[model samples]
Target: MKKRKLVMGTFGGLLLLFGAVTGFQTLTLESRQPAAKPTSVEIDKDKALQHLSEAITYQTISYEDRTKFDFSEFDRFIEFLQNSYPSIHEELALERINNYALLYKWEGTDSSLNPIGLTSHYDVVPVLKGTEENWEQEPFSGTVTEDAIWGRGTLDDKIGVIGIMEAVEYLIQEGYQPKRDMYFMFGFDEEIGGEEGAKAIAETLKNRGIRFDFVMDEGGAIVENMVPGVSQPVGVVGVSEKGSATVELTIEGSGGHSSQPKDQTNIGRIAKAISKLEETQFHAELRGPGEDLFEFVAPEMNLGMKYVFANKAIFKPVIEHILLQEPASAALIRTTIAPTIFQAGEQSNVLPEKATAIINLRLMPGDSLEEVKSFIEKTIDDKQISVSISGSEATKVSSVDGWEFSTIQQAARNVYGNAVIAPYLMVAGSDAKHYDDVSNNTYRFLPVQITAEDLNRMHGTNEHVSIDNYLNSIKFYAELIKEANK
Candidate 1:
């Protein structure tokens, strides 16, 4: 009885010690932001909004089946670009790849300097069959109201395409010239996996052995209330993108009558296997760009958050437990498992022979496809169940300390003085992924401040951007160009 009491006391003391350590760490992390510098940029909001509104009118939509796409729209969009930005068209050399992907090269005064590339896709996803009426304005109308510009591509990257042009046009008008060559690339079919668009462009550049100092593509944007501790708009520059893979688990057995069933049938065995796999997920480790996110934000956070994050080494378990509670934070740290499709028996009366399940996995950086396959096989450990996996592994993690990243962050800060710019891992694939082959450093960032709801509207109904946000995005691009030149 005495020994049991002693053990209980020790356990309670240990728990109290852990809690205190976590609290102190959080405080330390939060207290470290000694100062902040506010930078400013002059912006022409009217021209920026006008360009974005007009860019949305072009129905450069991408379909999974390339045959279904209207190439004329893409051609018309290019013509529109040429007509709108006369100075740019006259100055930069334009090249077309696969007849649709647009690449513009702006020669700098210095040929010795390595070039930087900025890329975005003009194509937007199709409006769902039922959600068309739910839109406040027509998806393709490009309606610029008093407050917001409403359209399909306005946010899911027509803003990026137009924003860059607007910035370059303004810069050129003010006699600003790039010291290093700048390339602007627009993919026609990024929505449909960029096979004909970004992929072709990347290959063309690769064949020529053209490597960039760094390439910036559409990725994380400034979002309000995204990170728990910080109040400022958090602009996340994607340092890495998670790899996507599909795993199929299948089992086959002889058909039998339902009246007399065996202890476990093919259906039962497959179901159990899937359950086990879900139960025992891929190992979660806190590392990579995701970890880098907190490292930057924690310094500017409140005392409680700062302390917890600062002492993460000593309070890792508690910090991880807190991170796991929020799905957004959880995704940042670990691989995500989603079972997209499950197929089994066709008939009701008799037990069928086959069962199958398809699971989609988003791999963390440093994880191997072979290792993922091995993990799934080992976890599902039924000899009868067969597994097959296929997909791309995660991209290389870009260096946050490099001038490539600092240029982006500094430029963003210059445009949006209060925004907290930080590096993060991207979950979705982008044209930036294709650039990984040509550029040693690939950074993805879309300079706009948005709320969580705006993210939903990216491929959903009522997709729009505030006029202010649109202009800021242009300023950000302009500043980025200038910063890169420096």
Candidate 2:
């Protein structure tokens, strides 16, 4: 009876210690809010909307096969920009790279300060052939309905292009002079790898020995219900983008009739290899940008979630396991494996001599392509299957505790007073990656509030943006300019 009582007392003491640790963590959490000095810049809503609508009419579609591009449309779009913003053309020095990409320099009073860059792609993905009729309006009509503007490029990017132009024009009208040099770069072929557009532009600037303080591009945006615990809409700024690699697994061996097949066939081996890879995925651990995301949001989480995240040192494995259950969340902490294409025999009775499978991988910030290849070779553990990998490595992680990031957060908070602004990792590729060599830091964010459904419309049918969202985007750009210069 005395031993039983001692065991119970020890158990109760352990529970009390756990509770005390969690309570202390929650109380000591830091606030993410920054002092915001927003601009009172008034935008001409009607004019900005008209510019976006008209800009959409020109189908600046990018195709993998460059010969299919209609240069006439590109020429017309350039003409429209020249006519639309006279002040920009008159004051800023404009240079055209590769005959289509635009580079504009807005010289500041102080050349001592490093330049700032604002980049956006004008080229858009081609609308699926048969899905054009499914749209609420014609894909290229650029129709402005009652509340929303309907078109292809409205949300994907044209918003960024027009929004920046409108803000600069408004600032020019308000006689607001910047203290730092500003560069507005528009890429013509971002949808198709950006090799000729942004990549070439970055090379040009690097050769000139020019460097920038920071470069802002279109990426993450404000969304509701994105973070688990935060009730307010969170505005995510992407500090690093995941690397993309295409790994091909191929097997070449003898082919025979299905009726008299060998004990092991090419198809069976490839299938087994893929199965093994799916079953044994890359290790999932909470670190780098993924950990930073939770750290920023933990303080704002409810008591229950706050307790778990605040004590992350002890609960990291549990949190990672929970996050790994969802595909979207799993991508945050580990390299993703997706089998995209498989090519094999054409006839049912005959086995093909060669079978090939293509796997697309989105690598974590610190993961190298060579390491990914090694993992696959080790995981499959088959000498017969030839493995080949090629792609870019993950971008360098940017600083979150610096004034540069604080300026962006402050601008977003100043405009979106209710939003919880935080830094995150981007899973997809963007033009921002091209500027990494030319700038000290590159940030990816599009100043707009969108729902999950709206996100789908970026490259899908019925793409649209509301009038209020577009206007707010312009205000954000204008306010960001002021904030960064200050």
Candidate 3:
């Protein structure tokens, strides 16, 4: 009886100690967000709204097939910029790469300081044929309503191009010059992978031996209902972007009549392999930018969440399990698998001799193409199935310890005062990946307040942005330019 009581007492005391350590960590966690340097700037709302609206009409669409690109539309868009922003065209030295990608340099007085690049793409994704009818306004109409600006490029992400231009033009008008140089690059083919546009620009810049202090691209945005335990909106800055890998799983076997089908067919084998992969996904752990995300937000979380995140060392499994429950959150911790296409037998009655499936994967920072391909082979564990993977590895993780990231975080907080700005991993690929070689730090973020729905509408039908959001985006850019220079 005494031994049983002693064991029970010991267990209870251990629990108390565990709780104490967690409580202390939670209490001591500091907010990683930098002090806000909010700047009040006035924008001519009507003119800015008109510019974004008109900009969307250009139909500068990026298609996977390079030959299909309408260079005429791209030329028209370039002319539009020259006509609209005279101050920018006059002050900044603009050059065209491959006749579409626009690179502008605003020479700084001090040559010792390296330049910072602000980048985004003007090429919008082509609206799917059948989905055009679903739009409230024409997909390329550039309709400006009293409350919102309706069009395709309003969101993903001609907004970034126009916003930066407007900010620079405004600054030029206000007699603002910088000691540090600035570069503005707008890619023409970002949606289809920036091989010809951003990649070419980076190569050109690299050949020139021009290295950058920092480069900013369009990515994470101010979002609501994204981070749990934080009631207010959270602004996420992407310090590392996930690599997109395309995996092809193929199987070949003998064909047979439907009535005399073999016990195991190619289609059946491929399906089973996919099933195995789904059952065994990549291991999920809290590390890299994903871990950094929680560290920044834990201090602001409610007591219950704060306790769990603060004591993550003890509750890592629990935290990972909970995060894996939601797709959005699960994506943060590990690499993701998505089967995009399946090509099997065409005839209904004939058993096909071959089966092929293409899987799309977003790789976390540490996950490499070779590692991912090996993982797929091992998980599937079928000798007949062959796996081939091809794609870029994850980009280099940028610095969060200094003003490189804090400049962006502070700029965001200054505009969206209530948002919790934290560093995170961008699951979607962006042009920032191409600039990695030329820039010391590449940060991806679009300065706009967006919702879950707004994200969906990026490459979907009915894509539009509220006038207020558009205006705020301009303000955010203006603040970032001034804040970064300071």
Candidate 4:
């Protein structure tokens, strides 16, 4: 009886200690959001809206086939910038890389500091051939209503180009100068890949021995409901971008009449391989930027969520499991596999001798192509099947502890005072990745409040930005310049 009583007391004591530890962690978890002093500058509302609308009228679309690109439209875009912002053209020294990418250097009073760069791609994706009719406004019409500016490129990045240009023009008019040099780098072919546009600019500056203090580009936006626990709108900055890679699986075997086919044919083998891959997907581990994301947001979340996240040492496995349930959350934790193309039998009757499948992957940081290939080979476990992989690895993670991030965070908060700005891993490819070597740290964040629907509209039909969102984006750029130099 005495032994039983002792065991009960010991169990109660352990539970008390556990609760005490978790409670202390929860109470100590503090908000990482910088104390943003809200400030506003009067930007011409009518003129700003008009400028973005007019900028969208020019169709600078990127095509997969080089021959389909209309360079004349790009020419018009360059002309439009010249006519729209005269002071920017005359005051800042400009160079056109590859006759398309624009690089503007704004010299500062202090030569001791390294220059900063603001980059965005002006090129927009081509509207699908048949999907044009799906748009509420014409795909490239640059439609302006009472509340919004309707067109392509408004969200994907033309807003970024025009926003930066407009902000500089405003500052120039105000006779403001910076202590550190600033470069406005705009790429033309980011939609397809920035090979010709962003790549050339990085190469040009690299050969000249010019290194940036930090380079900012268009990426993650401010959105609500992005994380399950947090209620306020969260603005995520891309500290690192996941590498995009292509992996292909192929099988070749003997072919015969369909009537006398063996139990395992080429199509059957490839399909079985795909099934195995799906069943044994990439292992999910919540570390790196994904872990950082929760750390910053934990303090802002409700008590229940804060309790779970604050005691991460004990609740990490539970948190990872919960995160793995959602597709977007799962992406933050692991590499993803998407089967894009599958080719098996051409004709219905004859058994095919060859089968091939192509998969598109977004790799997490520290995951190499070679390791990915080995995992695929092991998972499939079929000697008859051959696997091939190709693509770049993930970009190096940037530091959130530096002024580079705090400047962006502060600027974003100056305009969006109520938001929770946090660092996250970008799942898509952008021009920022090309400048990885040229700059010590590269950051990607498009300053706009967007929704889940707005994400689809970016490269899809009916892409548009609300007039207020458009205006606020300009404010962000203007504030970013002021914050960076200060």
Candidate 5:
């Protein structure tokens, strides 16, 4: 009888302890929200859609081989813009760089304030020859259906170019004047790396001592079911981008007949090195913009998830374990390793004299190139297998707590009501990085709400955008401009 009584009491105590722990976690998750209300501005729908459709018809495609690019299409696109937005041409000072790239300055009433810039690329990736038949409409047709507008550049960034122009044109029509200076930079060759386009523009502006308050570029968007626990649509604004690095592992000087092969051949050494790298990946830690994502979503999550995330200080390992289960989430925490190419024996019977493997790495911020190289050398622990690593370092992280970021979030929320706006790290590169030297803060966000299919279409077949989304994106830009000027 005493044993039974003690067991009952112990079970009750355990339940109470679990409840207490869970309650503490829930409280922690409920603490992230902005202090100010995001303001919204009205946008013209029909005009924005018309502009987007017209913007897509030009095959302003970027080619890695500069000579292959048809500058004639770019010239036609420029002529179209001149005809499309007469108000902008009459007001803003337009300058052409390299006869392809463009920069426009809208002088504000208050010249004392540093300007805010909006940027997007005009070039689209060439539609693969065989894949063109898969598109719902011609890649450059710019079809406008009742439900959606179809084309190549609609989603990737013609939306940005046309959206900004539509907003500015509308603002001019409305007689709305901005207090701070505004600059619009359009890159001609962002796809093949913006060396002659965005980089050149940045150098020119930097030389002129034109420092900006902040710069906005195309990146993260409002997406559904992106967060595991949150039900609200999450609008992610990118504050930093991961660096891309390629590591080549090569081994040479081993050859023999299949029957007379050594205990360890060139291929064997290369394989072992690759296996080691895969087994020992970079350490995964929850910090920076990744941490910021959870901070915003946890409070809105269910009780069970909220509890776990709220007490992340104590349950960090558990949260990381859950996150590591997903490749998308896993990428946020650590540098990834992908073996893209491998070369070994040419003939099946004979042992190879040399072997090589190429590893693609997306480095986390603060992880230096030299440090990563040293770590790889130590991990493989093979002196004979030489490893060479090279790539650009990660971009500097921007401040999410500052007014510039908050204003961006606020503007997005006002335009995309019911969506939870949050800051995160971007995995891909953007022209926003080029302006890092001049701007105090650089944010990457394209305020269009989209589905998983839409994401696939951004760089794939059936690329498109709804007429409503196009207009909404323009409204977002106008609202953002108005909010920042205040």
Candidate 6:
């Protein structure tokens, strides 16, 4: 009886100790207060809005098949930019790569400081054929409704391109010159992969021995109700984008008639292999940018959430388990596996001789292609099934503690006073990944406030941006330019 009482007492004491530690950690957590807003810079609201609206009218679409591209549209878009932003075209040294991608250099007085690059893709994804009528306004109309500018490219990116130009033009008009050189790079083929646009530009800059202090590109945005515990909107800047890999699993074996099939057919083996992979997924752990995201948001969380995140050393497994519950949240912590394509029997009655499946994976920062391939082989434990994997590894993580990040955070805060600016991992790929080699730090952020629905419009039908969001994006770019110089 005494031993039982002692064990209970010790367990209760341990629980109390844990509670005390959690409370202490929560109390000691750092506060994330909004920075003081910068002085407002006035821009021609009508002129800026008109430029974005008009920019969308030129159908500068990027198609996967190079043959399908209308080069005339790209030419018209370039001509439009030159005509609209004459100050930028006249002042900045412009270079065209492969006859499409644009590079504009705004020379700074100080050569000792490394130049900064601002990049975005003007090329918009094509509106799916059948979904054209689904749009409230014509997809290529560039309609200016009472509240929003409706069309393609308003959200996915042309905002970045036009917004940057408007900011630079405004700054030039105001006689504001950067202390450090600034470069504006616009890619023409980001949708299909930047191989012909951003990739080639990076190589060109590399060959010239030119490097940048930091490169900012379009990515995460200010999202309301995104982080559960935080009351204010959170502006997530992607410090590193996840790597993408395509793994092909193939099984080949003897064929047979439908009635006289082998006990283990090719299709059966391939299906079983896929099932094994689905059942045994990559382990989920909160580290790297994922952990950094929580760290920044935890201070603003409610006491219950703050307690868990504050005591992450003890509650890591619990947090990870909770994150793993949702597909969107689960993707943040670990490498994700998605079986995108499958092929088996040619006919329903025939027993196929071969089966193939393609699994698309977004790799976490530390996970590599070789490791993923080996994992597939080990998980399925089927020598007969051959696996091949190919893709880029996750880009090197950038410095969140440096001035480069602080400048971005401060600039965002300056424009969005109520937002909680935080660092995060980008699950989707972006053009910024190509600039990783040319810049010391590559930070991805699209300075606009967007809702969950706005996110869906990026690559979908009826994409549009509110006038307020568009204006705020312009202010953010201008502020970022000033902040970079500071």
Q: What lDDT tens digits, residue by residue, belong to model 1 across residues 1-486?
A: 999999999999999998787766565444212133343556667666666777888888888887888888888888888888998988889999999899999989998888899999999999999988899899998999998999999888888899888888878887888998898999989998998888899899899878899999999998888888788788899999999999998998887888887899888888898889778877776788988888888877767677767887876788777888877788877888888898887778788788888999999998899999898889888888999999999999999877788888888887777888889999999989999889979998989888889999999989999988888888788888988998
The full ranking of all candidates by TM-score, starting with the best, is 4, 2, 6, 3, 5, 1
* Winner of 4 and 6 under lDDT: 4
Model 3 CA lDDT for position 270: 93
TM-score of every candidate relative to the true structure: 0.93, 0.98, 0.97, 0.99, 0.94, 0.97
Angstrom error of the Cα, residue 152, model 1: value is 0.6
Clashes of each: 9, 0, 0, 0, 0, 0
Write one digit per residue (lDDT tens) for candidate 5, span 1-486: 999999999999998998798786577544455544544456656666777888899999988888899888999999999999999999899999888889999889999999999999999888878998898799898899998899999998888888888888888888888999999999988888888888888889999999998999999999999998788899899999888899999988958799988888898888888899889988999998888888888887877788777888889998888889988898888888889999999899999998999999998889889988999999999999898999987888898878898888778877776888888889988888888888888889998999989988988999999877887888888888888899
lDDT value, candidate 2, whole model = 0.92
* Worst lDDT 10-window in candidate 6: 31-40
lDDT of each: 0.86, 0.92, 0.91, 0.93, 0.87, 0.92
Better of 3 and 5 by lDDT: 3
Model 5: how far residue 343 lies from native, Å: 1.8
TM-score of 2: 0.98
What's the residue-level lDDT of 345 in candidate 2? 99
Q: Clash number for model 1?
A: 9
lDDT for 295 (candidate 1): 84
Model 6: clashing residue pairs? none
For model 4, the run of ten residues with the poorest summed lDDT? 33-42
Error of model 2, residue 106, in angstroms: 1.1
Residue 233 lDDT in candidate 2: 89
Q: Whole-model lDDT for model 4 versus the true structure?
A: 0.93
- Which has the higher TM-score value, candidate number 3 or candidate number 4? 4
- By TM-score, is 2 or 6 better? 2
What is the Cα-based lDDT of residue 403 in candidate 5?
Answer: 82
Assess the local accuracy of residue 140 in candidate 1 as a C-alpha lDDT between 0 and 100: 90
